[model samples]
Target: MPHASATARTNQMRALMGGAFLPSFLGLAATRVWLQVNLFASYTQSDDGLFTVVNNLAYGLVMVIGAAIALRKPFSKGNRTTVAWLGFAVMTFSTVLILAGKETGAVDILAVASVCAGIGGALGGGMWTAAYVRLGLRQSVLYGFLSLALGSLGGLALSFLPEALSYTVSMFMPAIALLCYQRAMKTDVGPQPAPEPIYDKEPRSTMLFIFGGLAVFGLALGISRGFPAGEPVPMDALQRVVHQMGVVVISLFIIWWFIVKRKRLSFSFLWRIEIMLVAAGMLILSVFPGHFTGLAIATVNIADTLMLGVLWITLQDVARHTTTDVYAVYGFAWASRVLSRDAGRVLIMVLGAMGASSYAVTAVIGIVVFALAASMALLLSDGILKLRPLFTEDVAAPARRSAAGAARETRRAEMEGAGASTPAPAAMPSAQAQPDPQEWFRDAFDLSERETEVALLIAQGRSKSYIAEALCLSENTVRTHAKNVYTKLDVHSKQELIDLLQNRE
Candidate 1:
């Protein structure tokens, strides 16, 4: 039984890894290498940050437009697929233009490429966001973290490849991402109708708090990137590799904390960490100027990577629980981040062009850092940070029920001891009298027959081994079914399942 259980876990991990690869590959192929090495280098001749500003502006606008359209007229499955293919084609053509411009030194070609890349990338991003929404919370987090880790590794590997080879490989990333999307379409089920209320009582406030926080963070990131400190030091291949490694390390730790340890990670906790990292990085940049620039950059990258993972998870959670169009939610959230970052970058550039003194630049950094800290504090004080339902699992419900159950038991015992004529407890309801909870949940969540059986045994307090023996299935198969049941029911454990059933009764 133990061996089978281990095997089942291993297989599950493999499946998640497989699912994560395409997204990670797509990310690798789409932006990091191409943007940094090709476009940025080429455009630096005209203006160091012009390409980035244009790229980000175009990207943000596309996301906003796409989201607005989706809100007004949600795309059918056929339309979504068609749009995604179009996006893939556009992105590929953009890459070709970039290469052509690089070879021929045509600034116009690169400018057009930047716009194409941004539009194409936004379309592709929406498609991926929809795919993630279908995975729910836990699966989405796992897949998200794994994808980040894999993308980091891919980036690290590309650092070793010759520039020509790397650029060549990058051109094919959109096609690979599309292939992965197709694979997901075949293997995964469509989004099920939510049984509970989809609309929140005060969704606008919740969204403002969440997306507003992201905007501040993004602005800080942009300031850090654009800060003038003796001409920004371009990260060498070694530095790039180290940066990627740091991302990988951080991604693994988050996966362990969120998935393996199953800890409750509040958004407040995430914000606190990010604020500190950004503040520290900015302080370092201000004090040292030219020295330790890599260290400062590394801190910013780590903070951004962490924020991005949680942000994606939070977006998915909101989309799942709310009536707001999922595409709009994702699009607006992304735009908020991107556009704000662009604002910060542009702010710094304007200041630099104005011949701002070092002291003034330092002052600006301090103000941005202060704004971030102040915003985070406001969020915490407003109870917005405590909005776990928008990000983390609400395990407190089960804990509260457990405590209430104990109190009821104690009250019943006291009543009996007092010799009062308490009414006899009603007889347990039969399957005919009340629908079997396992069967009901099965129908509601669209759980398979095997999952229904597993849930029933689990609620009865049967061990996995015992259930496996009774059902004549491998422990691994039983374990898989149990997991599916838990995910479908949105419960964390067997005890929660039991509490849920009792409540239903």
Candidate 2:
């Protein structure tokens, strides 16, 4: 049994690392490397700040528009695949145009390339979100960390390549990502099928809170990126590489903390860490100005990377637990992030245009940073940012109620067995005469062995925590099985399940 469990786990990990993993890592690396090489890195040297700003604006707007379309009318799987491919093609072409424009000093050509890149990036983001929403929470977090690490490495590698070569290599990355995404969708590593979307009891409030928090983080990151004098200071090659390596180190530490130490790392914890890192970076940048600029930038970059991982995992969690259209949820979340980021950048630009003094600019940035931190604290205080656990303790009340009902049934049976004179109620039949509902439901639903065990316990009025303890499984794993059972049995709630098992009219 141990060997089999180990083998299954190994297989699951392999599946996650292979097909399910590549798209995110490759897509992120490719986008970052491309933008850094062609836009940001060359901005000061080539004096193309306008191009950089235009690209970001276009990217943010197109992403929101694409998300809106997706929310309104999600594409079929085939259509989505096709759109992803189209995006890859556009990105490739845009890369070529960027290369040509750089060689010829054609601002118009670069502008066109920027717009194309935005459209391509938006499409690719939607596709990746769809793929990520399918993974379990642990799987999402693990992959999110590892991919961010690997993606940072990939970007670092590409940053070293000659400009043309880098562009040439990056052009193929989106296509490869699309192919990997297709593979992930086709592959099934577990006995159960992909989980179905469940009805969200409070999607509106939940989404609003999640999106609002992310927007604050995004704006903070954007403002930090645009520090000093509105225009972003691009890191040189060595600084850029070192910054990415720092991200890799952070990712490794998180992986160790979560997996090796077996700690429960929550989203709220990550949120706090991000806020602290951003605050520290903003402080350094504001105080020192010219000195330690690289350090301040690196600090913010690391924070952004961590926040990105958190964002991916949080979005996936929301999608799994909510009945909101997965595409719509992803679309809205990403849109809010991108738009807020642009808004932050524009705010910085406005300050720069107003000819604000260094002190005034620093004061404004500090104010924004404080607001961001305070807003997040408010969210945490209000319990708005608290994620729903995979298995909630709310089930305990239902289990207790069901246990009392069982006890009453048992007492009634005893009275009948004792030959009591008073007649028992007609509605409450003896459970013994009923077909074993556990086995009946198990067989009818074609449940697996583990699922059968879980179902039996649930039918016996066991709370999720009790079942987890009894079965020696994590509550999250148990929830997965429970969800599978609920989905297969066509039931929505524990009480409904108990009533069905009791053969109640």
Candidate 3:
């Protein structure tokens, strides 16, 4: 009876293991078959229609499997670390599948399916990683990072091949990883901490990330453009030191923004913008990279401006989404960008007969892609509308409340001030007539009251010109008073004056 009990337990454990690997194995098979079919005509040029048809059916089936598996996450262990481990496993397993495909036979897959699978897997893994991180599973960070490293390696390595081949080569790594992520993708995966609302006040981290990213980027431009190409752009010793320092400053700023401020570039916005810009950059860069002839250079120039601006805005979004739910969205964006760029190669192959026009067509295509991306950006800005309230109701709440309180106080003070003045006793009281403290100041300063008034005006946040108009003084006269006021106030600059008033100290 004891032996039978042990035997039954062993069989039960064995049965339980089936569901674990079953989905992943199916996913891998689906990816392989689907990819093989999609690329069948384009790469292998095989004449068999039956194989192609069978592969297509297999590809669809794989997605169904993926969808099912993706939905199976049970939300257990409940930490980002667990998520990280699971995500890493999924990623590694997918990569192994990819390796298996390469070893067994990659030529049999459909190109489009391959790209889709690869993209799906990357996203799946990223999604799981974020779930873990957001849940505060720091211990699992190593695993998440490992998945990223391996996934990146696979992406880059696979990129070297023909588009279809690369897609086929790349598809499984994430799928395999997804296998391991079953427990992490649950609805209850993270801490489920509600998003904090934010309002008018800019996030310190966001501003920091933006300025820092821009500064670093700007420094790069300064370095690359500040000097002549062949001449080494003559910043001898001292200048070089300054330039180097500038780069350091920019780099430091970026680090502060990305890490310290924890201001993230949102994933959705980045993807929307990055897809088109990356395509544009590749197109433009393809023309001559560093140098180009008239039309070519002209063609690529749009990309340069767009790339910088896109990077400037999207960095914030990317930083934040990289850790939250649907984290794989970032991977999806990257995969889209990668596919869009690489898929362009297909056009080259199709139009190979046109020779120079082929390249020209590519240039034209780059422009079109850029325009499409711009349009997409416009569309995505609307996406922000949907997310805005969330980002607001959640992230901006405190700041908005604080501002509201301040505004209310200001209104209260103004009401009190108005009530304090009995207009019945004072007709111009609305205009203020207390010794025209304005006039007393004029007499005391050995200057016109208007000048004193201007000094007071400068103290208030009014610009120099506003003060001139208010005092009925010429601009030059106002300037003179400003200088005198500065001297009397023992302030070196207007900024000092403003700072003094603004600071309670």
lDDT on C-alpha atoms for all candidate structures: 0.66, 0.65, 0.37
Q: How well is each residue in 155-184 modelled by candidate 3, as lDDT tens digits?
A: 323333574465454444444544544544
User: Which predicted model would earn the best TM-score?
Assistant: 1
Off by over 4 Å in 2: 1-48, 192-199, 378-382, 385-387, 390-505
Q: How good is model 1 by TM-score?
A: 0.72
RMSD of candidate 2 to the true fold?
11.2
lDDT of 2 by residue, 43-162 (tens): 222113566567667767776676677667776787677766776777678778888987899989988987787667666656766666666554566767777787778767776778
Error of 2 at 431 (Å): 27
Sorting all predicted structures by TM-score, with the top scorer first, yields: 1, 2, 3
Model 2: worst 10 consecutive residues (lDDT sum): 390-399
TM-score of each: 0.72, 0.71, 0.33
Regions more than 4 Å wrong, model 3: 1-106, 109-193, 196-255, 261-345, 353-369, 372-383, 386-505
Provide the RMSD of all predictions against the true structure, rounded to 1 decimal.
12.3, 11.2, 21.1
> At residue 25, what lDDT does model 2 achieve?
32
- lDDT-better candidate, 1 vs 3: 1
Locate the minimum summed-lDDT window of 10 residues in model 1.
39-48
* Steric clash pairs (candidate 1): none
